[model samples]
Structures are given as structure tokens and as C-alpha cells.
Target: MKAWQLTGFGLDHLVLNDIPKPEPGPDEVLVRVSAVSLNYRDKLLCDGKYNPHLELPITQVADAVGEVVALGTGVTRFRPGDRVVTNYCTRWIDGQPTSKETLYSLGNTLPGALAEFLALTEDALAAAPAYLTDEEAAALPCAALTAWYALVEKGQLHAGQTVLIQGTGGVSLFGLQIAAALGATVIVTSSSDEKLARVKALGATHTINYSRTPNWENEALALTGKQGVDHILEVVGGKNLAQSIEALKPGGQISIIGILDGFDSTIALFSLIKKQAVLRGISVGPRRALEDMLRKFDELKLRPFIDSVYAFNDARAAYDRLEKGAFGKIVIRVRD
Candidate 1:
């Protein structure tokens, strides 16, 4: 089977090569990967920025959609032809995250989805939504699930609540759609007016072109008549935290999910104190959360926004596009 391996710990270490196809163990299933999606974490892994360094010669990318080709003994949840998507966090099968569950993530501590065939525990796989193509399904496990956990599980987003998403990246876009599906009014922010306009058409009721209007927190406050939004999906870590803090109403929540803009930030202590705001950090999510998200996708017929698809052989090129900050999810087709 053809797979892309990280020969060492840097971007220059990645190389494509042929390796023996994997066989499933007694409790595992062998899946023929159909498509793999790129996330910001993939870029960090390539750049050697992820903590708990990945092992060399390992495949990259945690999120993928595949077809089960062989099921090992005791694997009863899946069959040979079932279309499946594996959870990024393989160990968190149920309940809150534990040290054990956090230790065995796919593509980090174990083998990943960037290969033609991957062997996984049956517990790590979920049936793909019937409405999604392989490329679209591939995009869900990380970014989509993060959004669902941030807004649905943590925020408890209700209909008619207002949501503010910091950027138009994969997770933020998923946040927009999910919030919209739940009947929340979504406000999107982007440095580019063009991108903001595009997101508006996708159900954002309002957009703040952060480049043109630098004080976007004021704009958000004005848009809500000084009450501010009910929730915020914050991606920019250091530079935008103060503004995000000011853009929330009393008791509103902000899910600090990414550090696209650097890790440190200056915050207004008074705003947090006065608003009684909740700021929570989110990892991808658990297997049960993935299941709930798939159910919602199926119920709403939600289609992931795919920016582009590259062939498996061009996996590095896909990473290049993600590093350039392309809109939506970038995918690699592993099979036809």
C-alpha cells in the first residue's frame, strides 16, 4: 500500500513510499481509506509544533473516511462494505477525556489515515452520514466535531441565540452551519471582505470585515444593541482575545479552540469580571460526540464545505494549501 510517512520531525522529512498493507488484530478492522482531510494540526505536525512529538515513519492526518474491507474477530459493529469514519481521539470512546484516552490518538501516538489501508479498533469507527461523499465525510472528524462539542455540548446553544465565529476556517465554518441549523443568528469575522461576504451567503446574518473595521468588538456590540452575542467560537488566540472578551453578553460563553494568531494574548480583566463570561478550551472530542454530530448531519443533511480535493499522491501539496490558509477543508482522495 502507498503511504506518506514523516521520516523525521520536520516538513523536509515527509516522503511518499510503498509499505506493507496492515492486517487487523482480533478486535480491529481493516479499512481501505477513501479520503483524508487536512487540519491545522496536520500543518503543526509537519512543522514539529505539536506537543508529545509524533513518532517518525508514522502516517499523518487523523480524520479520514473509508470502507471496511475486513473485520477481525469480535468486531460486530461493522462489516466488510460499511462506509466508516474513524474518531481522531481513538481512546475516548465514552464519557469525559481521561489520561488513557488522550494518550492514544490516531495520527499522533498511533498509525493514521494518510495511507491506502488503516487498521483500527471497531470502537473507533462510526458509520458515515449517507448524504456525504468520501471527501466531505473525511472533513468531519476533527473540525466539525470540535465545533459540535464547542457549541452544542459546551455552549448548549439554543435557537435564536447569537454566535460569533472569529475566522472562516474549517472549524469556524462548521460552527456557523451548526449554529445556524440550531436557529442561532451567526456573525462571522474575516480580514477579507470577500470572504466575509461568502460566509454571509452561507447563513451568517452579519459579518465584520476586521480589516476595514478594526474594532470589531464594538461592531458586534452594536449589532446586538449592547447585549453582545450568546456564544463565540474563538480561533485567534493572542491578538483577538480582548475583543472577543468584550463581545460577549453576561453569562455568554467563548470556546477557545485554536491559536492561529499565536498563543499569548492581552485580556481585559474587567470585562470578564463584569460579564461573568465563560472561556473554555476544546480538544477535538470523544467517539460519542462524533456519533451525535453524525446524527445531526444526517438529520439536517449537512454538507461540509469542501474547498479543494487533491489526489493521494499529492498529499504534501494538500498540506501546502492548508498552510496557505485556504478556505474550508482541503481533502486528499485516497481511492476513487
Candidate 2:
């Protein structure tokens, strides 16, 4: 089997090599990976920013779509020929998360999907949506699920509501599509006008070039006739939260998912108190949530927006594309 192993932190150390193929455990399944998706976290993992102490020589991705070649004993839910997608957090099943459930996150605490073959617990897999191609399904495990969790599960987003999504990244684009599908008006922000125009074609009711208008919050507020948006998918943390609060309607929800701007910031409590806004932090979400989102995808014919695809041999180039900034998910096709 071929896999990209990180013997040390940094893209320079990510080596593609042949290694012994893994066999399924008693409760696992061996999947022949067809496609794998890249997340911003994969870059962090490579640069030693995500976890400096992570063990070396580990496989490097969590989200993937594959065909089950063999099923281990006791795995009744899936069988040979099933096309499945992986759960980013292998142990998070349902409801409130526990530390134990989040311990073995793929590409971080355990070996991941950046290989021709992978053996995963039956619990960590879900039936891929029939409407999606392997590369599109590969994008669902993290970015799509995170958006679903934040908007649908946590925020209880509904029709007629207005939502503010932070950027043109994977999660935000998903947020735009999901919010629009649910009948919500979407306000999208980006640093690029061209990207803003692209998102508008995808159902964004309004778009703001945040770079041109640094106080994008005011633009959001004005767009809503000074009442502010009902929900905000706040990906940029740190000082950005202050502006997100400003863009929120009283009692509106803000699901915090990213810290791309910076990790820490001084937040003024007065804003939260004045607006009575809800700030909820989101991780990738549970397996059950993934299942629920997939059902929605199937019913609605929702397709993930794939910005680009690279062949398996071009894994490093895929990482470079992710690093540069992608309008949607970046994927690597492991096989035809």
C-alpha cells in the first residue's frame, strides 16, 4: 500500500512511500480509498502548529471516501462494496461530546486516510450520499458537517432567518448553501470581490468584501435594516468576535468554528451583555450528526463545491493549494 507519512512536522518531511497494508480489526473495515479531502488543520499538522508532540511517521488526513473491500467480524452495519465516508472524530457518536470521544481524531491522534488503503472502526464510517461523487463525498466529513452542526444542530436555523458567514472557505460555503436551502437569507464576507461574486451565484443574498469594508459588521447590520442578522457562522475568532457580535441581532446565535485570524483576543463583555447574543464553539461534530447531514444531502440533492482535485501522487501540491486559500474543498483522488 502507498501512504504519505509525516516523519516530522513540515511539508518537506511528508514522504510518500510503500508500507504494509493494514488488515481490519475484529470491529473494523478495510477500505480502498478513492478520494481524500484536505482541511486547513492538515496544514497545521504539517507545520507543527496543530500538535507539536504528535507521533512521527503517521498518515495525514481525516476526511475520505472509499469502497469497503472487506468487513471484519462483528461489523454488521457495513459490508463489501459499500461506499463509505469517514468520521473526522472517530469516537464521537451522539449528543454532548466527551473528552474520551474526541481523543483519537484522525490525522492528529491516530493514523488517517492519506493512503491507498485504511482500516477504520465500523463506528467511524457512514454510508456516502449516493448523489455525490467520491471526491465530493470526501469533502463532507469535516467542513460540511461542521457547518451543519453549527447552523442546524446548534443554532436551530430556520426559514426567514438571516445568517452571516465569514469567508469563502469550505465551512462558510457550506453554511451559505445550507442556510439558503433552509430558506434563510445569507450574507457572505470575503476579502476578494471575485470570490464574493462567486458566492452570490451560490445563493448568498448579499456579499461584503471585508477587505474593502473593514467594518463588515456594520455592512451586515445595515443590510438587515439595522436589526442585524439572526445567526452568524463566525469562523474568525479573536478580535473578530467583537465585530460578529456587532453584526448579530439581539439573542441571535454565533457558532464559533475557526481561529484563522489569531487564537486570542480581548473581548469586551459589554457587547455580549448588550446584545444578549449566544456564542457557541463548534468542533467537527459527531457521527450521528454526519449521518443526519448525509440524509439531508441525499434528500435535497445538495452537492459539495469542490474547488480542485489532484491525483494521489500530487498530495503535496494538494496541500499547497489548501495553504494558498481555496474557495471550496480541495480533494485528492486516490484512485479512479
Candidate 3:
């Protein structure tokens, strides 16, 4: 078997090598990976930015769509040939997360998905939405589920509400679609006018080019008739969170899901206090939320937008695309 391994701290060190594929063990399933999606985290890991101390020479990437080619004894939930999507959190099946559940995540502590074959505990897989292609399903584990968890599970987003989505990346695009399908008005912000126009066609009620209009939060406020948005998906961290605070309605919520801008932020506590705003830090989500999100997406016929696809051997190109910032999910097609 061939696996892309992060042998050292940088992309230069991410080399492909022949390795013995594992047969499934008790309660495990052997997956023949069809496709794997690139996330910003993949870039971070490759550059040694995610965790400087992360062990070397491991498979990289946490999201994949695959088929169960074989199952170990005691695996009762799935049979051979079932299409499956990998779970971001291997342990958190439902509800609140504890250290036990959160500690056992992929692309960090556990093995990753950037291989032709992977052995996973049956609990770490979910039924792929039958309507989606493998490449599309590959984006769901982290990108799609983060949006679903932040909006549906934590923010309690509902129809008739307004959501402010920052950027046109995978999570933001998923946020726009989910908010739109739920009948919520969505305002999307991007640095590029071209990207903003694309979001408008994808159901964004209003668009803001943050590069053109530095005070985009004020535009969001005006778009909502000064009432402000009911919810915000705050993917850009650092100083940008202040703008998000300014864009929120009183008693509204902001779900912080990324640190693209930087990790540190100096915020005015009084702003949140005065607005009675709720800020929630969101990890991807639990497996139950993944199941619920897939069911909803299936019913609504939601399809993930793929920005680009690279062949299996060209996996590094997919990471390059992720680093350059793609409009939607970048996928690596594992099967020729």
C-alpha cells in the first residue's frame, strides 16, 4: 500500500512511501478510500503550524469518503461494500464532549485519511449521503459538520433569522447553504468582488467585499436595517472578531470556528456584555450531529461545492490549493 507521510515538519518532508496496509482488527473496518478533502488544517499540519510537537511520518488529512472493503469480527453495524464517510471526532458519538472524546481525533493524535486504505473503528464512520459523490461526501466530516454544529446545534438557528457568514471557504459556503435552506437570510463577506458575486448566486441575501469596504460590519448592520444579524459564523479570528461583535444583534450568538487570521485577540468585554451576545467556540462536531446533518442535507438535496480535484499521486497539489485559499472544498481523488 502507498501512504503520504509527513516525515518531518514541512511540506518538503511530506513524501509518499510504500507501507503495509493493515487488516481490520476487532471492532474495526478496513476502508478503501475513494476521496479525501483538504482542509486549512491540512496545510497547518504540513507546515508544522498545527502542532510543532506532532509526531513525524504519519498520514495526513482527517476527512475522507470511502467504502468498507472488509470488516473485522465483532463489527456488526456495517457490511462489506457499504459507502462510508470518516468522522472527525472518533470518540464523541453524541452530546457534550469531554477530554476522552476530544483527545481521540484524527490528523492530530490518531492516524489520518491520506492513504489508499485505512483501518477505523466502526464507531468512527457514518453512512455517506447516498445522493452525494465520494468527493462531495469527503468534505462533510470537518467543513460541513462544523457549520451544522455551530448553526443548528449550538446557535439554534431557525427560519427567518439572519446569518452573517465570513469568507467563501468550505465552512462559510456550507453555512450559507444551510442557512438559506433553513429559510434564513444570509449575508456573506469576502475580499474579492468576484467571490462575493458568486455567493450572491448561491443564496446570499447581501454581499460585502471587506477589502473594498473596510467597515463591512457597518454594511452588515445596514443590511439588517440596523437590527444586526441574528447569528454569525466567525471563521476569521484575531482582531476580526471585533467586527463580528459589531455585526451581531442583541442577544445573538457568534460561533468561532477558525483562527485563519491569527490566534490572539484583544477584545472589549463590554461590547459583548452590552449586546448580551453569546460566543461559542465550535470544534467540528459529534458523530450524531454528523448523522443529523447528513439526513437534513439529503432531504434538502444539498451538494458541496468542490473548488478543485487532484489525483491521488498529486496530493501535495491539493495541499497547495488549500494554502492558496480555495473558494470551496479542495478534494484529492484517491481512485483513478
Query: TM-scores across all candidates?
Result: 0.97, 0.98, 0.98
Candidate 1 local accuracy as lDDT? 0.90
Q: Sort all candidates by lDDT, best to worst.
A: 2, 3, 1
In order, what is each prediction's RMSD in angstroms?
1.2, 0.9, 1.0
Lowest lDDT block of 10, candidate 1:
96-105
Evaluate candidate 3 by giving its C-alpha RMSD to the native, one decimal. 1.0
Q: Please give the distance, in angstroms, between residue 232's alpha carbon in candidate 2 and its true position after superposition.
A: 1.0
lDDT tens digits by residue: candidate 2, 1-336: 999989998899999988999999999999999999999889989999988899988999999999999988899989899999999989888889876765688878888899999999999999998889998999999999999999999889999999999999999999999999999999999989999899999999999998889998999999999999999988889899999998999999999999998988677799889999898888889999999999998999999899999999999999999889998999999998
Q: How many backbone clashes does every candidate have? A: 0, 0, 0
Candidate 1: residue 13 lDDT (0-100): 77
- Order of candidates by TM-score, top first? 2, 3, 1
Model 1, which residues run further than 4 Å from truth?
Answer: none
- 77-178 per-residue lDDT for model 1 (tens digits): 999999999898887887877656646877778888899999999999999998899999999999999999999988899999999998989999999999
- Candidate lDDT (C-alpha), each: 0.90, 0.92, 0.91
Residue 211, candidate 1: how far off, in angstroms? 1.5
Two-way lDDT contest, 1 vs 2, winner: 2
In candidate 2, stretches whose alpha carbon ends up further than 4 angstroms from where it belongs are none
lDDT of 3 by residue, 3-86 (tens): 888999878898888889989999999999999998888888878887788887788889999999999989998999999998
